[model samples]
Target chain A: MKVIETINLSKIFEGVVPVHAVNQVNLSIEDNEFTAIVGPSGSGKTTLLNMIGGLDRPTSGTIKVNQIALNELSENELINFRLKHIGFVFQSYNLIPVLSAKENAEFVMLLQNIPAKDRIARVEALLKEVGLEDKMNNRPSQLSGGQQQRVAVARALASKPDFVLADEPTANLDSKSAENLLDIMHRLNKEEGITFVFSTHDQRVIDRARRVITLEDGKIISDVIQHEN
Target chain B: MIFKVAWRNIWRHKVRSTVVFIAIALGLWAGLFTSAFTHGMMNQKIDSVIKMEMSHFQIHKPGFREELQVKLLMNDGENIVQAIQEEKEVIGVSGRIVTMAMLGSANKNGSVRLNGINPDDESIVTGINEKLVEGEYFRGVERNPILISRKIAEKYKVKIKSKVVLTMQDMEGNIVAGAFKVVGLFDTQNGMYDELNVFVRRDDMARLLGVGNSLHEIAVLLGRHDMAESMADKYQHVYPKLEVLPWMDLSTGMRMMIEMMDTYTFIIVGIILVALLFSIVNTMLMAVLERVKEIGMLMSIGMSKTRVFMMIVVETICLTFLGAPLGILLSYGSISYFGTHGINLGDAAYADMGFSNVIYPSLEYMDYLVVSMMVIIMAVLAAIYPAIKALRLKPVEAIRKI
Candidate 1:
């Protein structure tokens, strides 16, 4: 089941010399697929991921998530679509510093107007799965870098998005923390059939991904399937 | 959830937020207290003017006050006074033989407005008897007794039982002079009023000026200050030939002073609020700038612009309210304390300028509410610039920033 598809997607940042950040990229992401969009510096992995998640307006081309053309949506509609369908995990842990771990985890569900009881139940389960149940009441400042990332993960998944987008989620973590985060995500992808698309330079993330899509100078150079469940 | 985030966000920088809170509180306290002081001073001036100089309103035959024409006297002064005294609002009425004259002592000569009145009626109308510092209102000297202000006495080198000659034109336009002994010295605390006025017995003045029983001025004191204008209007209509004026109209400068002071009070409060507004704007802008990455994350996760804006506004308002209550309590406490105990501005300059030296700071309940409303409005306005700054954040770019 195709959850995301991009047809001839391109983005040009106009300047003294216009830079084509993402050019003529065609991609498809299916449900339960653990894919990594891999590239070096100045490559278009992050730009492509942003367009697919409805976070940026494409200069040209149409991005369809669940068959809804993202380019056709207004700014407000795009935000609503992202809230309902997509989750984001950033390179730096972006958990609200003022909120507790549980509060941060429940933030998305709260935005979705979910019932308090259901939200509490789901958030608790997600935090426990991320192994932060013990630290639920702790603020981000009180948590380790890896623990904060885990809270971010729980928070992204709280609204039960159709797919989660991870943009170098383990870039700032240590080797052990990175390995732990990848394993947790891999387990969720397999057991719950959750889809994830990561944009990363991290070899560890690429090694764990079931499919690797490589890009150079904003164009796809290679796509290789590692293993399928 | 947005409110929760906003509330917690304010306390994130405890020291900064506290500073902003204190700034707002102190600003409000200063503004309100200053307004109270102004109000107290003006109220005192108004009370003194109504009670001593101009008794709510006064009446005179048309053209009598402007020219001091002795012949243009109100021939039916006694009837007019009797009729006005019948009104329920009327507290006291006095028909006066008023004329501008020269009061000459042996050593010096001074210009004065001679108020010739029945001693009892004059005392009731202007409370002049209570202001006497020495001697009596109408007694001590048998043949001709006159009351002089301390300013007049000091200037003319006269005292109780000292004889003074008043010279003025009679109804026939002939210059007539009479010697009257100063029986009392009164101090009205109004320098200008005390300097220019002297009182003599109406019968003595009438005999000296040969005006028979005609009165040049009729002063009426009303129980309530607010009733002065309507009663003046009523009397003006009843006696169309007479020029009736309320205390506010007797001297247009007095009216202007009252209005100008009220305006100045609000302006002073407004200036303080505006200064505080800038401080709040700067503080909230810093708060927004500090959380660029976090705010971007919230937006990237689908928080609407309105919610983002409201979050900032609520945070700013929450911060302001922290100080607002403290400021209001401070203002209230100080106003109450100073109002009762009085703030004696140890300066005779105020008395010399026709105001009491001691001020009792006051504010109407409505004015307090108005000041609070102004503060709330200021807080909201202050939040706008910073909230807009937050709303302008683009998640794509802002996330890229550290």
Candidate 2:
């Protein structure tokens, strides 16, 4: 079943002359599918990804995730839904600088008001899974780029979200770190059945995704499934 | 966990956090010092009034306090004392005689009020014996001895054992003339008390006034300091004709003026606090703006906007908590240092202020706590606008901030 479906999604930055960042688009992503949205700079891949993640509103359209319409939720309900159902990994490896690797992973769970014992155990297990158990106590500045990105991945998975959004997650990483991160993400997707959607221009990432969706000038050009379920 | 994270965040940006901490600390310190000094000054004034003049409570000839002349005593002075003695809260009660007299010395002269009191009873209200510098206090009611103030002594150059003549109208409307030996000089320090007041024994006053064993005013002391008001209320009901004036009423002008000074001090402090509050608000707002992308990232990771708001507020509270106490501590040290060796507003400046030899800025611990709490609260309040701004920020726009 489609875990996320976008119908005629569009976003226009209103001004003296409105700039159409994301034009009319329709796409569907299946559960547990590793999908990538690839485009050049200002090609609206990030904008399209934002709309799907419920991080933004479409000027007109419907985005359904797990069969619930994203556009229909109030500001408050959207926040609650996101905390429980959606996770994001960004290019900046945005692990809070002050928090340790483990703490960065555990933050979303804290917001969920999860009990401390469960939170601690989950964070520990995730850090180990990310191969950051030894560096769990290290803060963002103390960690290498790849290590920080791994923590970010661990954080994204900590909430047990049905879907994860990665926006240029490998942009700041070297080839080796990027490869290592993708392998870990792929493993998590296969083993845990967590869905992954990434917005990226990295060919290595595009070559690896089970599905690829291409966007240009704010509209999807193609939707191709390259790998079998 | 939020508090722990917030706390660590403060230390992460060492220099910036330190600056903020110092600002908060300074705000709190200044607030504490000002409040403490004001409170201390008030306490000092009240103590002086209670110590030197009004003995907690006083009974007077129904109208004698307003009209300054010795008059008929309370109809039942002994009975009143007996009644007061029955109340556990009554510390002590005394009979007092008050009359106006012309005071003269070889070099200077002034008109002064003479208070006739019992040596033993006066001791119950205030430390009169300690204030006596030159000579002994009156031995008994018949000694015809007087204790004049140090200022009066300085003007008269009258030594202990010197005889001085005083003239005043007695209660019966007769002008009584008498000579009394100056046994001691007291320096009460208060302007009104020091310059023109003398003390004589209650018996001699009764003799001079021709009131046989009757009292002009009954002064009662409370067992506890704070009970003066309630005690006075009881005294009022007990003796309708008698005026029950607490020490607060005795120095009304001084209290009012002190309160006025405190109000002015608060206004000045409040202005500074508001400025500090704005500085804090501006800093937080700037921080929120700079971290918009990060905030969006957090929200996208399934963290709510409410969580974002809480995190910002936690950071603010952490910063302020870190700073406020240090400021209060510094203020305490400064106030203490100045309190002992007063600020010395310069002798000329001190004189200009119409105060004594020194201007002491003193405070108590509770003053520090209260002020620190207030500054912290204001600092927290300052973060509200920024926190709400963070909550209102759309995740997409914030993440894509140019």
Candidate 3:
């Protein structure tokens, strides 16, 4: 089953001169598939990711997630839909600065109105899986860059969304921290069958993706699949 | 959880939060203290006027007050006094023969309103005996002895036992003149009243004016001045022929002063809170602007716009809650202490204003509650603009904000 399908997705930024940020992009993301949307600067990868996560409305497009038409929903309805079915990770490691790692992980489920006992159990399990169990009580500022990203991943999965959309999730980390983050994400994908769609130019992320789509000037240039992990 | 996050968020910028907290606390303290001081001054003025000038209520023949003529004396003075004293609320009563006359000494002459009283009854009604600053109150003095204020003595260059002559029209239209000695000098701390009034024996004044056993005014003191209006109404109903007036009617200027004190206090405090409202809005706006990205992150994670708005409002309210109670406590302690010890505004300053030098600050319990509630309300009003500002940020754009 496809988790998200976008047909003829386009976004135009109107200014002194119009710029087509995302043009006629067609994509289907299947359940439990780890994919990467890779591109150079100005290629509209972030714009595409934002649309898929319901963070932005398309100039003209139809987005169906779990067979529900995204374009037909109001802005408020789109927020509710995103809350129930989609999770996002930004490159800046945007963990709430005042919240501990455990609380940050539990935040999405809290918004979901999950029972406190179940929320605590799931948060503990996810933090342990991401190798942040011991650092659960530390605020975002007290954690390392890699640890914060791992907490972000745990937060994204806490809502039990159909897929997680990450925009350059490893761009701000050191090489070793970037590698550790990728390993954690890969392990979670393999063990838990959680799907991920990331927008990145990082070679380390590209090397680890099972399928990669490359874009240039808002158009897909190549679509390739790797047989090796 | 939203409250917990908001509470922690305020402390993240300790200096900013502390600045707002201190501003609110100090603003409330200043407003309450100033209001209490104003209430104190008004209370002092009211008490002075009631005690030395107009006892709670006064009764008079209808035309006497308008004309100040000796002929307008009450026909049955003894019966009116007996009726007033029978009222359950009345604590003291006195009858007086009041007439406008000119007082002359060897060196100077001045116009005065002379009040003739039986010294013992007058003491119970106005406590005039206690205000005597020199010589004896009409006690142990010979016939035609009088009491004049120290202001009168200084102006006329007269002293105790100095002989002064009073000149007035008799009830039969004769211009009568009588010689009297100044037996006592009284200072009532009311410069205007002191300079205009002189107290003499009622018997002596009646004899000189040739109106035997007749009186112009009956003053009644009540157990509580707050009961004055009701008592005055009752007296007016019973003595329809006589004019019954409460202190508020007898002195319109002082009554207006008391009423204006309440209104002006509210207006002044309202202005202060409005100024505080702007300051609070500015601070909270800065907090919201600085946390744009974080706010975006929360909204993207499905914290509803309503929740986001409430978080900011709750944060502002929490800040006020932290500061207001402390301000109230501090103001209460200071007002209580000063109320007992009294704030002396110097003799000259008070004398010029026709009040006593010492003022005791006062506040009702409700004032503290009202002021604190006003601060909280101002904080809530202050939060609205900032909260709406937070809601206007689109997640995509806000997440991109540096």
Top DockQ: which candidate number? Answer: 1
DockQ of each: 0.82, 0.61, 0.75
- Tens-digit per-residue lDDT, B130-231, candidate 2: 887767777532458888877678778887877777788876677887788888888654555677678888778778887766777777777665887778
Superior candidate under TM-score, 2 versus 3: 3
Of models 2 and 3, which has the larger DockQ?
Answer: 3
Which runs in model 1 stand beyond 4 Å of their true positions?
A: none
Give one digit per residue, the lDDT tens place, for model 3 in B1-402. 888898998898899888887887788888998899999988888888888778899999887787898888887897888877888888889999998899999889889999999888889888989999999998656889999999999999999989999999899988999999988999988777889999999989989988888789998899997999998998899889888999999887887887788889888898889988998899889989999999998888778888899999999898777778878888899999999998887766566576777778899998888887788789899999999999999999989888
Q: Name the regions of candidate 3 deviating beyond 4 angstroms.
A: none
Q: Where in model 2 is the C-alpha error above 4 Å?
A: A113-133, A186-194, A225-229, B22-36, B71-91, B139-144, B170-177, B202-214, B254-283, B323-380
In TM-score terms, candidate 1 sits at 0.97
- lDDT score, residue B380, model 1? 94
Residue A45 shift from truth in candidate 3, angstroms: 1.4
Per-residue error (Å), model 2, residue A171 = 2.5
Error of 1 at A7 (Å): 0.5
C-alpha DockQ for predicted model 3: 0.75
> How much DockQ does model 2 earn?
0.61
